[model samples]
Target chain A: MLAALPNPQGVSVCPRRARWQLDLLLLALECVDLHASELMLQVLRELQLQGMIPNRVVFWQIRCTNPFRQVTQRTPLPLAETKALTAVVVQVARRQTAILRHLLLVLDQLQAQNLPPETYAPLAAYLDRFRRNFRKRMNLQRSSLFLYKNHQALNELGLKLLAQLLLCAGTKGMERLWFSLFDGEVS
Target chain B: MLLQRQYSLPNCTLRIEGLSGQAGAEQLDIVTCCEWEIIGQNQRIKGGKDFLVALLNSVPAAAQTWLSGVKLRRSPQYPIQVEIAAANQVSLHIPRKLLQTSPEENSESPTNDEAGETLEVHLTWLQLADLVEALDQFCSDSQTLPTLIPTFHSLPRRAIAPAVPLRKQLMPLGIGAASLAAMAAIFFHFPVPERRPPREEALPPTPEAVTPAPAPTTPNPPNP
Candidate 1:
């Protein structure tokens, strides 16, 4: 007899591509706060969500699924882990809501004036940090990573991710992010 | 006795009036009235608790995909509807029934259809932010309903894809132009010196010419 399969709705596992997106979001969260790992633990503890994330080792394991990572993990991420990571992202984004709003407003002003993002000190620092973090962690040999070879391309990616994170911080952010993760995968 | 609490921001003010419920001081107050005003626009709307609940639930989803908008509506009793009108605007549609139609006016215009009439108020993003902030404050108050906590749902993927294409196309061009301009400015400020100039002995070297120009600032591209 064949082994029973897990019910899709009852034991929903995260899709393959969502792992990459989740890791990118986590990377963005780290750019926002250097101590993001510790903060994630704190949030899990505070929200009584320790059951989902368990501990730091498990957290790192889930993050290791990012395809760009130098040594990628082959295991699939479950939905619970996905929710835990998303909660952390949303919490961090919520805490920085004012700053995000300010940055976006500044971006609009710069765009209107035709000034580069580098003209603004805070935004420049963020984009630079994201680029540095991306370089230090990701495998540059990957074909997808090859497209981000130029400074301008990486910076634009950073800005786009930043804006997406802002949207994730807004109302119903958790739900919005949850559904978006499964966007194309679901029939 | 009726108690009133208000949260105010730069562009909006939210006011709530209620009385203590029979459940005692430990329980939430029985909300009697809820009101919101767009500060500079000189517009205000009044409703009961249902409207407040609808607003609290609608704002977050609306904030995410603003162009498509999320509507707040509660059946026959509370017909007021709120929708995101644009990137930075919100429109509230208040039914004419809630406006306290005057008896004299009703008599003078007997043929006027009340069902088709509504008073619409437009609010800028800043004003909407203020209202959201105010509602968040209200939600945090201990005297409010614990079960009615705000919840957000993401719109369908198809609805959001069409909203962002224009911004996506225009941003890169603007940034590219700005980057080129900055590069040109740097090049203009520092001139490279050529070797073996016969005119070097004829003119005194200025302070800037004597010193080497600083390295141009550029972000290091990721290694391939």
Candidate 2:
């Protein structure tokens, strides 16, 4: 049996790294589907976890904890909100497992053939959207974001993040993601 | 009376037989017999409630580590343990207590004297995926154990590998680079393969010297 998280309520603040990871995963989900926010809300309702996230406004508030965001929130994200977000992300990834697998397979084939990512329409679209989203939402002045100034760099980051999201869809994905959030923060 | 429920897939089948416990009208039946079978393989395990509980508990977390080895055990009293035997394979160890004895004591059969013996069933990942889907279906059934809802819990701190210092993490790379450099130095000292002159037959005809081949005519030429 796994150990319960220390705080069930929204008392304890989530670790900064966890917040960044969650936000990035959410970004990858958005790249996968344009209406990801709506899908997340629907999943939240389906999972009966609305009490923690409440609505879109509250969801946006929690997601703003990502330091790279252009309009970042100063307040630390709450553990409850983190759990809710993680749950939603995992559920979304689970639902998109087939598509995710297909995209990754295509990516592998492309890499094997030494073909550019744009050769495949769907994958090219996903990477292009990811780049645009990152550029629009992120504060480019931030050291990390500044490094991804070029389209190619941003595309590579997007592909890496997409693979990570796929991992989050695997079995025990929820717990795996939860533990990963606290990776270096614990010790 | 025993009630049997099974979830079947193209390659796998999970069957559970149990009696309705003192559960009220809305509650699920108590599981007693559980069997997992993967077709085209000599893999099968028969257990009871303990096995089901262990499976239900472990599965959600089992895939957490890239499907790394996971050992599922409820308690000592429940002598069944399920764990990953190899990459792409899952093994369930059913205790001898759960094993039935044949009327004729064959030498090949496990005898009562053989204590602490277990029958192990190995299943491929595809088979495991089917089993997990079946378990998920079982968990969703409102009539099943109402308290048996699948939930995710964070792994304990100790269970997670502690983050290594940057220096420690880089040490292996440094060692690898130094060894590679040493190997390269040794390789440079060795003699290279002697080059042989290309044979005339092996050489392709020069473009200028090459002549275009004549187009072959059909055996039955079309009337022109």
Interface DockQ of candidate 2: 0.05
Give chain A TM for each model in order. 0.89, 0.92
Give the 10-residue window scoring lowest on summed lDDT in candidate 1 chain A: A1-10
What does candidate 2's lDDT look like per residue over A1-187, in tens digits? 1233345323367877677778888998988888887899999999787777788998898899898899998898877777788888888988887777667667656755788778999999999899888889889998866778988788777766665566567554566677656543442
The reply for model 2, stretches above 4 Å from the true place, is: A1-6, A9-11, A37-64, A67-74, A87-187, B7-13, B22-30, B37-50, B64-133, B146-152, B165-224
On residues A1-187, what C-alpha lDDT tens digit does candidate 1 reach at each position?
0011111332367766577777887787788667776887888788777776689888888889887798788887876667777787778778777776676667656765789988999989888899998888888899878977789888877765665676666554555566556543433
True contacts kept of each: 0.08, 0.06
Measured against the true structure, the TM-scores of the candidates, in listed sequence, are 0.51, 0.49
lDDT of 2 by residue, B85-178 (tens): 3323456555555543332432343232345466555554445555666777677676666677766444344455434655899999999999
Task: Judge candidate 2 at residue A169 and give its lDDT.
Answer: 72
Native-to-model Cα distance after best TM-score fit, residue A122 in candidate 1, in Å = 0.9
Predicted candidate 1 versus true structure: per-residue lDDT over B1-224, tens digit per residue? 67777878655788888776663454447777888777766656676777666566555444544421222232113355566543334676655555534434434322333555766566645455566667766776666654556543333334334334668989999999999999999999896876875654557789999899998989999899
Task: Note each model's CA RMSD in angstroms.
Answer: 22.4, 23.5
Q: Which number leads on lDDT?
A: 2
